[model samples]
Target: MLNRIETYYDAVPRSSARAEEFGPLTLFVQEGQGWPYYARPALGHEGDVPVAAVEKVRARQRELGVPEAFEWVAETTPGLRAAVEATGLTVHEHPLMVLEGEPLPVPEPEGFTVRLVGADDAALDTAVAAPFAAFDAPVAPGTSARVADRITAGLTRLAAALDATGSAHAAGQHQPVGTVTEVVGVGTVPAARRQGLGLAVTAALVADARAHGTELVFLTASDADVARLYGRLGFRTIATALIAEA
Candidate 1:
């Protein structure tokens, strides 16, 4: 199962770059093209093996516009940590949690409902772009605009992919309080925060994934507080992925 977990992510790669398989080993370029992110490897298989593997992936990541990446060393396999460190890549430790057993409590807002998002739903489209509305902070105009553009573009692309893969959903009336796409983006309007809207939309998506026969649903959240909400819905941390500028 551990081995399969790595392969599952390798299969997706977050980008369009092809994943290469070499016996029990696999390599690929990460998508969304950025830094301080992971270049994952399965547990065990240490020493010269991962060194050679990283060399191969490093070249591939470079070709895909990434100069640096980290490997996710499972707590169960700390030996792989030493191997990764020896390969000249800095390593960090983080917990990997998983929620099993019964389903979590799925709460909905007083007057809203969770349902599938149509491609033409303006509320869903606006909620999808809500994250970008926070782009302008302590940063300058161009900085926020560029980041916001990337985020909007990424969400648009993801919405298209989810529709293609059959997993886009929306919540609320003509104007939604939140939106969620697969195991990806989940957000609500400022006025609607803490109203259980995010959890409701997320639960709907999880139900969709389970109905489709997917055993696991995962996501990476930079904010620990928001992650706690997901934790309540049976999403375990698994890993903390850090991102840095390229």
Candidate 2:
């Protein structure tokens, strides 16, 4: 079972990258999206390029008209940070936490029941898409429809992939009150908030995890409310990550 949830920083770039070159280092670029991510050793290894190389990547991103945000691991060297700073980047800090205790046995709520979802289930898609709606950003042109389609498509693909790999799990029967996938991302809907529904969903996921021999539950927390919620469910902060956005 996965221990810590590998973060958005580690995978987002890689996920976005359509083409990559790897040698003693890795350079990943999402040409259409204008996102560029490069990585190399910190100890001045021969294959590793200087901090200027990263700045060059950022420059390429700028030239591509991408939003000027750079996401990277905190383990990046001070030299790299200084170079990025000189080029005008601001750092944003956040912590990642993992739940360590045995999974809580999910109990049925009044008027609701928890159960696993089938491979064809659509509630999982709706469950994951609801959070994006919570963000009040004006829907970009075509984004309102596209986001839902994207979420649905992504969740469908994810469900199929997990089913093939035996990684999918479902809870909250019929209407699917809750769910948890093998991959790191999990959430309850906006309509499901405050009624302890989030906890109920999470507990359902945890129960499935425990039955599957998972030793830990890992998740990243951004909001203090979610952080406190996770804490109440036995999650503890594991590490802090600093992101530099230009």
Candidate 3:
């Protein structure tokens, strides 16, 4: 399962956008997207990458003008965390989770419905904007256009939760949530959270993935509470994710 998840993550940037190789690392770069974080360093199961290899990864990120960041499964790449940290980068650890068995039936919460909007510009705008508002962060310029590129590339399926009046209250995407189908970008507006909209949208995506023959679904939660929330829907922690950022 971890191997599959790792493969999925490695394939995402390669499949949808531009992927460049630097020795043992793969760099995903999507320029002009305003979402600098989208440009990532993907290190797979290459065990104990040499310090020079790590420097090359950082050099490539600098050349691409993207943030210096990479995510890897520590167990898969032994000593990688120490190597990255020695170079003045910070490593953050989190659970790498996967959905197990059958997902519980997630009925649409009352007064809300899940909508599959695909890549429609207007609908995408609402879907993209809701998270920024919910998190109280400025909507980075050009993010919508970058996301649209991914959607139009047939790389993402966008979903959202709407109120009775049809206003988008929360949104998310079901993409190769790493190398397998997984739900991501699940977020609810402050006004709409705690009412089960997040679960509703996620469940909708899970059902859609299963219907399309995707058997194993996976995602990385922001924290334990989010993990626990998905746990109720059948996701289980399978490994730990180590992320290094400069």
Best-matching candidate per TM-score: 3
Candidate 2 on 15-90: residue-level lDDT in tens? 3464333222244555443214544222222332356666666665677565555443344433445555677778
Which residue pairs come into collision in candidate 3? 8-178, 8-179, 9-178, 9-179
User: Per-residue lDDT for 94-210 in model 1, tens only?
Assistant: 333344543587765556655645444444444444433323213223432333354444432212112222332333211111222225545554555666666677676666555
Question: Looking at candidate 2, what is the lDDT of residue 162?
Answer: 21
In candidate 1, position 76 carries an lDDT of 32
TM agreement with the true structure for every prediction? 0.57, 0.58, 0.88
Task: Find the 10 residues in a row with the least total lDDT in model 1.
Answer: 172-181
Kindly report which residue pairs in candidate 2 clash with one another.
114-172, 115-171, 115-172, 116-170, 117-170
Question: Model 1: runs farther than 4 Å from truth?
Answer: 20-27, 30-38, 42-56, 71-73, 83-95, 131-182, 188-192, 220-227, 235-246
Question: Stretches of candidate 2 above 4 Å error?
Answer: 1-16, 19-51, 75-83, 104-109, 113-119, 137-192, 209-216
lDDT of 3 by residue, 113-214 (tens): 787766664567878787778778888887777678778876777778876666779888888552378677788889878988888888887887877678
Error of 2 at 13 (Å): 6.4
lDDT of all predictions: 0.47, 0.45, 0.75
RMSD of each predicted structure: 8.7, 8.3, 2.6
Candidate 1, residue 122: the lDDT equals 40
Better of 2 and 3 by TM-score: 3
Sort by lDDT, best first: 3, 1, 2
